[model samples]
Target: MEEKFDLLPLLEYIPPSSLDYLEWVSVGMALKHEGYDFHDWDVWSQADSRYNAHEMESKWASLGHNGGQPVTGAFITMKAKENGWLSRQYEGDGMETFGWDDEISYERDYRFVDKAWVEGKEIQEPGDNWNPVEQLQTYIQTLFSNDDHIGYVVDSWQREDGKYSVRGSGVYTKTAEEILNDLEKYKDQKDLGWAVGDSKKEAGAWIRFNPLDGKGVKNENVTDFKFALVESDNMSLEKQNAIMRELELPIAALVYSGGKSVHAIVKVEAANYAEYQKRVEYLYKICNKNGLQVDSQNKNPSRLSRMPGVIRGEHKQFLIDTNIGKSSWEEWHEWIEDLNDDLPEFESLAGMFEEDPQLAPVLIDNVLRRGHKMLIAGPSKAGKSFALMEMSISIAEGLPWFGFNCERGKVLYINMELDRPSAYKRFKDIYQGMGIKPANIQNIHVWNMRGHSIPMDKLTPKLIRRAQKEKFDAVIIDPIYKVLTGSENDAEQMAKFTNNFDKVAAELGTSVIYCHHHSKGAQGGKSSMDRSSGSGVFARDPDAILDLIELEVTDSLRDMQGKRATANFYAEKIRDENPSYLNEIGQDDFLSAAEMRKHLAAALGDDRAWQISGFELGEVQKRVKLQTAWRLEGTLREFPKFEPVNLWFNYPLHVHDEVGVLKDLDYVGTDKPYNQRKAAVKSRDSAEKKAERKKKTTDELISAFSILDEGDGVVRIGKLESYFEKSRNTIKNWLKNQDVLMIDEEGFVSMRLELD
Candidate 1:
């Protein structure tokens, strides 16, 4: 008869106590439906404290199929899944096979080896120069520390089939130190049996890979939970060695079993028994997936492995290698996962040389490309956030952003630094200020993550999943510091953090645009790429970087702007009341206050013009004073370099300088060398000192005359000396060159009058 189906292995994952009565009954019914015998169910049920020995067998027999549909093995599989049992398939000679209904889906591929590409490595036995005592001592020292209790079985009994098997659980009371000492003491005799115990030559020996507590030989008695055994007898020995090396399993010791299999003690380094079980399961799953057929029965912590330096009938079970793979379990696991990442495969450049490969479409005309990244960096209150919001609107409405045309498509604005209401109002304000209608308002999506923002590493996947179906052309993140994951100055950490943006852009097929702040200093002298406040990776990683630097608006420019604004205010008032008056005024006349007043008199009559002349025009002057000038420099990867664009931040919007008003303005420090800047500052200070001294002398003389004058508009020189803090002669000489004052030899001072 065919072997009874084994449900016991899967039952290890599903504890009976975790199940309710109905779920428990379902398990038994499914077991019966799958043709498993009653004994299997009874044995597994006994693990729960509620199990009644007498009722279990009767309950199992009564789980026969009724008139309704019978529960199949899928129920058992589902319960296993709920309890962390992954559904995996193994393909090799003599490995357990899954039925047609097994739901096989691996969350990630852990396979690091290919069977067809494996180059088998042959194992060579030691010649007449072999030392059994040294081999045994090395194996023991590599696996255990001095304080760890060692378990090894040497004695065995012959089975009825003439094959030898281990007789007992072996000795668990000896420490590794004692075993090594004994081996060294008996080295001169060359007798391995005297150090531990004599073993049957036919069975070789067995030793537990993990250290025990010196009190028992069960899984619970294991202390360190360190190593696990990986052995396979169904495949060629040479192939197993090659696959094990290819997978880079962290092996503490590797021993040939004198038979078809090789025993590899793999370092799991789990903290507890529970963690040990999980790690071993993961190790086995990875091994099986990679074409190394590991024996599933060797998973227990107390399971015995082949003891090296021992004889088994006509062959020797000898140590092959130690510390042969990765240094630690964590390092090895990371290497495997990185090797199997879901990155795209490589293609030969020669294959596409004959034809031009298509590039990602342009998202921001002449600045950035679709499915790429762009960074906008500037100082605080430079309207960086406003610029990003305007870009979003521009993309949605098919308009221009900072003089660059944008492709019209769906866009997502992730607001990480604003409250929900403020964010909504800002979008509306931008729309009104830009004078763009809401023709494609539906294309603009606002995800107000404000208070709920998380790190970029954790948020990127969620962003991808949500925006995958939106078919967006761009994703704009305002102020990246809210979700930045690591120190901005650390290149390694920032690289990992910024890679999340790449993931989002690649997964969603959208351009990712974000804003950052400039480094704390004058940004005039630094390159555009070096001005962002972070590691240089931030400057180099993106496809395009746009930097904003403040420009020094000269006093003359401000005065010019005030006059032009005042004239425009008058022109607008006349245009509103008398439309024909604009035709009478020339274009240059609108830029002059006198010309605008003459036009206003003709347009609205003298009474209205007089009323308009008295108007304060304070609001217009305030608008001019509040205006901030900036120069935008670009470092683009996909396009040719363009001239720097100048802008004016006029409250709610950044308006491009169309008439080159800001073209002559320079950044705060200019681009001069440090020494040159210092010299210019010194020269400016010297000139200012001369003008200030002349003004001070004139004020003192005028004040002294006013205080000493007795309605005659003249003051005595002796009284002026008290204010001058100098001699009378010095006071007289100081007034000799004054154009506004006349001093006589009699020591009296009077005002100087013009001859005209």
Candidate 2:
């Protein structure tokens, strides 16, 4: 008898407890009983839809198969149904019974098989040919021979019993050839397992794609990029594979991830990281187009996939498809050269601009809006980084930054210029200066990317992935120039960098702020934006640009150290906001009372003095340079003949006396000059000084109460006390003097200053 291939014994070798392994074994045995064995020339070709005789015969035999057997779709489906591993996932289907008249189609339909069988045992070929280990090594080498900068981890292995063992090795940067040369070192160790990174890196960090070459030599570049599809948890492996085939992805290998999923690696033409990302983007597009979920998260360039011949977690990880996308580097390049270049579709703009008419979402009011980009530029050592740190902490803690409303959120600070120690100290000092507990700064993450000197292109995606993973609401990149490899003056290069930042901001739904240095000179004649050094593109690209202008040293403004005590912050550019009144109109261009009356008529739809409350008047002033709603009670003192009416925050016609004004009008009262106002008498100081301080404190207390009333009357007593630094009784006494401000039945203070 010709050497009989004993299918029963081989099937028994597979653990029966594994549905996938058992399915494969059953199919091979079923085929054996049908008078067809691996010796038959067309068994696989006839059973699987993926093969044609002319296409598979030569390649299939070359994979060290004596044509003994391989798993087919029919076997897997039949075994799955028999084992009851599926839910109500199938309409109807079963494999043909070998000795019975009943027959069923073995095609997988709606079977909810989250996992499937792949060849576990290596195929043993005849004498002196390629051994199983070499065959696997060759397969791996061929899989990535056309690509460069591949990272692999070879320090881990699996035993024959399927237990994963690791020798504590880190990622090794090498080429396919380098890995191939070291195959013998690991071949005899356990099951000879390995894994390859999906992304390429330099100095242990993902290399950014930049056009210019810097001083340090980078890893060899990869022309042909590889992508892997991690099966969705919602679908069966059969369905996923079917979708991949339907989309016609150039799949190179199928790996059992030692769990319920399989990783399908595909090969695509990519000349650089830019091209690689585009290709991956297209992959996602096509999958979405076809209603398939291919685990887009796995497409990152730094992602790692299972090595073809590795053993993982009691399973032999072997290649299910060889001979796919396999070619020499030159051949691949040549082949791709002839194909038309295609780009991924631009991200959708639908529903992006839809906004509430009355309220807009803000990451930081008038400064850093969600999904917007900001540039904070100043002269070197002008505290731009310091200010950014303060803002980052405020955002993380949900506190206001420099009196600007801020939404609480997770923040990421990418430091590209400062050293790690300096960066740490800066953050620590900022928290301490702001009176925030270091332990309380929960959501601020700092990435110190300085000494390594990675370029922006390679760094952008990595940062994006980090932000996406961490769900950051704001990302601050310190000294944007350090992250850039190109000259700042080059508009094209700067545009590219800003565009990347904008893209990341949009994708993460967060605000991005980049610190920059200002050009040398006084900013007297220049707008806030014009002060930034580098191409105008940097200034123009962001949604907002804030400039910190340090004033010349003056005796009155200086601190004890005689340094310039303060800097003026200007919102040079707020895309949705009108220019500031102080910047647009000269200081001497104060609106006359008639002009104010006319402006109120136009703005509030009435020429008569109108009631304005909350931020309404301030908002109008910022927009149209309107006169402030509140006038000093002492203003009438200048004209002693005029009736005394105290000014409050509410706009237009209302000025109240010490007691009350018309029911339709409001007033504030002052017995002394506004500048001469004083706090309440807490000590036995002179009555003159005490009176002066009391008026000042009362004025501030009312203003504080107005601010705390966010269109609603409820005001926190503690808030007022802390903001005014006054005792509760003093605040209550001041409130008692004004009939418009009173405590409600709820024990909360309410502002009843509105005109009826």
Candidate 3:
């Protein structure tokens, strides 16, 4: 039985006030359908101001399983997902998952200082040399400009809990310059009471990290959204200081709080209040993820930091350092992200030589290796998906793929383009066309993600988690465009996008294979590596790049193939129903439809021949015309270059060209100069057509003579004209062009005997 998930927690991520009427009702419907109590819906709906008690009770009673698809918990999941809720798979103890839309760092473990290894650094009060005025001066100078208004709280009162808290909204009209001038004028005062207001010794003073508007002290009253406060009292003061420094947080001012925590005035440098909130949330999230356990309440732009140079009870709240880490917000962010790159460490070449590591085993022999990546690039309608499906079946059954031997192993085919039913039918059709029994059918797994495909970066972790247990040897994504994350033309963006493949390959230890379309225009003039669309990184990053370019099939070749196919079709029937007839037919006789028809007539007689003739040979020709020929060229990193493999995309299956007919066919564009090649080809085609016409005319004349000749071996020109389906003069001219016959003035034609 499938387990039912409790979706009540997902409601927390979604705000009830954000939804429309229908959406709000759907939530209740989903809750009811999932067998949750009406109170659960009522409690959740109460968050929205528009909620009415009467409407809620009425709507809750009305929601039930309708005739159509029921609104299940999945609707709630989707709503929650849209509101930035990631599934529980990403959550951990004390570690909240990043929002669905959050930029995930490449590595999850961003810890810089391990708590077990961190030692507490003792906090020291200013001694006899302490200058309280200078401490206050330095704090203001580091965080504020002369024109910026600063908000600070010096007045305090004790709460019922016996903890001291700030008394009113605090002062917000003082500028750094005015405060500095006041301090300089009162240098002899010895205490900050003369500069600002006197505070109780048991409660330290506080000042806003960000400069505020002179009007008020709320978040909107903040002028420059410059800095945020990172305070954690849960951990040892020493460890908090160590982590702040190790994290390289851009600190404008590092102040020691009198009682418990250190207030690190981290530089967020947000452009506005909205941006400030996001940056602060990210900063706090990162801190918590790395074991800092930051106090989450300080996310507002106008939040306070410990006021330096103040005395609280017996401890001093004073400046510890200024500008001690990365200089700016961008710099700090880049540094932290760089620390989480997750790239392998450098190893000594000598040590590696002595150890002699084994190379990854071949997955598709000479084409790809296990735990590597391969890209199959081709033009649209090139059957790239079908080729990938063939590869999947090949790997699953240990069969050959595109003439390359594949190791038998489990495969996961990610179908992002095709619908589930169509994708399934395609696989079945290919299997039947290839005439392979699915002995290891269980080895192939299909993940149909048609409408549900996410960006490759986001999908990689989820894919890795699911496939890790399967121990798949290869994972093939049908077409990458569905999950392509960034601008395909930008090299840097594409590089980041393609790196997800590497992540999947490394994490699951499987070969990652995917298909991409070729760039527009003639691909033949370019090398295989240059054919894939977008940035050159897509072509170069993979371990193997196999490009498919269509080969030009000539009209004569199609006709010959059509005849051969028709011949074989009848030959099979003859062999199956009347085996003795095939013995009388020569091997070469099967190459012509006419010869095959004669044999069929001899074997099946008039009745069967009439029935067989009803089958149109032109239909076979039409099918042959629809078939496309392709040449597979490869650029390999782990093996030597192999010759281009030629094959035909005959509908559901791709068959190798064993007869080498496609070998000499030039790709759509040759390397020759365009204009010159076009002229040359035109001239050659004209001359070839003239010769072909002459040969065809001569064959008809000779055949006419053979049928219309009298006992004396003489043929009348008029009779020959009628038989040849041309005018008498036209027949005479045709005879004149050929040396095989003669036509006299009386219009009597005679065959010429060879004189040896």
Candidate 4:
């Protein structure tokens, strides 16, 4: 048999005025629920908080159940340990009959009250009662039927007749039966009570339940049902129940709060914060339609309710149920997920476009449009967060970003990596740099979730609820990798994560910007989609994806920090609409000059004999591949002051004598002169075809010179000029050039050209 102590029937036998009796009752209920034999424990019979082990043994020896029965502390502890509830034992003061171990404490230890265990125990029917104690006990049992969390406050109201009406207004804990038994014993203690409604706080008008803090088996975990109490000034319980029944709400229990009002304890089985808000809103609207009074202020999740099982004024509050069984949270979640069906009636696409004149249906502005998702990707420690911070402020402040008009509205930036202090410092730095006061930047809320990586499933509902509470134009989640628990490379998992954000955007009508990391290596060669690490879902799913690449350090461009300043901001995928923002801003040209200079400084190291041939310049330019030639030319103009030298083939080489500067390049037959080459400007000829033509021309010239040199060892420059059908000066210059022939001071030339 399960050793059970029926504390309910014993309530009538115990005096209501004794505090010691009440405490003993509480201890006994807790002990009995854990299947412990408390009757033989004589220490519990005394009112003192502490009892000696010696006295416990003596009392156990004298007690009826202890006659030849094992009732000593040692036996009880051994039995407790055998049950696997006790972790270890310690020898403390001999007076300590039962207490928690100072070195370590376990939840199931005798000292710690497992309220959930107590609440789940089978109800023990009370004995025949003829006193007020039994009356109050029975009434208390009837009041808190569902075992919801409650609080209490002793309050007095001034009546119309001028007499003060006093009562205990309170709520109950998870173990309402156990707590209620103890509460009745303290009826004489003025204003003594339990937590009213769903919380342990005072409730003036109506009780409110905190959705995040429901009374569940795990006290710390959120419960499925959020209780909402309806209170009225001049409403009867019958009338309130009638209206509640008419609304067909999921009523867990109804309680009589006090004289003129009733508390309809409606329950909403919400899976998350967003569903909780929706359910409560729906409840409020339904109650109002039925002409029942409900305090709108009580709609907040943290609002308090009246404590069940407490005597108020002249009457005992009793719970009434509509006989509907408890709703399953799994089913309720499905119902809420189907809430999309209740969305406003649809309108034609053309009609929606016509309704909004200046605004497009989807695109709000250049930065981010309504109903669209954006990705801001960069390498780690590449100032991605800082760039996003500026963007967030711009959107919040209605300021232009990169010359793109920002659709001003409230923004939320969720930082999952940096600590609050570090994030704040960065924000301050950006604000000061922009010459904008922190206070001037409005509607931008920052949530620094350091050390906590909340997954998308858990994070989405919170963001949705927050957006619902206060309409947000955009929500930026920095370093999305931190909060994303799934594998980035897994297409299915990544798609699900991104789809969640898309849902948030669609539901809240707010744009979401996901700050992400790019894969290692320079981003210049790869397309924006390929640059981002992860499955293609991350790149393909978003409406717009932006890549910030640190351009390779080159000769002509250096960044503001005297480093390579060129950062390529690519609008990798801009779907459909072409916002002027992408076209108006040219970051490559804007920062290329500085970047080129920085690159040159690094490449020109050990400048001895450093020469820049047109071919070499063309090779560097090909790598840089900036759209415009002006950046290259501008960087070239900044080179160390040097005179142009005409070398082999009359090639112009900029000769710099300074160390660490490019020196004169050796003239080669294949190298074209600087003035003769169109290295910077784009050419009409294909590179392959141009190479072929140049080879043919060189062969023809060499053959012609070879034929002319057959008559003599040296050829006259004038004869060659006439034979080649070229000008005399041109021929003379060609003779003096390095590639053609060796010329003597006598004006004679050896035309036997050695062609490379």
Clash totals for all candidate models: 1, 29, 1, 45
Better of 1 and 4 by lDDT: 1
**lDDT (10s digit) by residue, model 3, range 252-276:** 8999998778999999999987888
Minimum summed lDDT over a 10-residue window in model 3 is located at 94-103
Residue pairs clashing in model 3 are 201-313
Model 3's lDDT to the true fold? 0.84
The alpha-carbon lDDT assigned to residue 704 of candidate 1 equals 80
lDDT of 1 by residue, 509-535 (tens): 899999999999788767788899989
Give the per-residue lDDT of model 2 (tens digit) for 1-756. 645432332232222333232333455455544455454424433433233457444543353245655444345333333333231223345221121211322222322212233212333212322233564565555455523435444444555544444433334445556556566665654233332332111111111111112222232333334443434433455555555554445665655444445566666556666777776655554444343444544555545555544444444444555544434334543443333233355654665457534433678765556767878776664566777887888888887765567898888988877889988887887676566675547798898887865677767755665565577888898887777768889999888877778667765778788888877655434555677888998667877776654433222312311111000111211111333333443333222333333333343444222443235444533422321122211111111322322222122222222332221222123232322333333233576776787677657756887788777767878777787788988777777665556776555887665668
Query: Where does candidate 1 stray beyond 4 Å?
Result: 1-108, 111-170, 173-207, 210-227, 230-285, 288-301, 304-349, 574-581, 605-617, 669-756
Candidate 1 whole-model C-alpha lDDT, 0 to 1: 0.84
Best by TM-score: 3
Quote each prediction's TM-score: 0.60, 0.33, 0.69, 0.33
TM-score of 3: 0.69
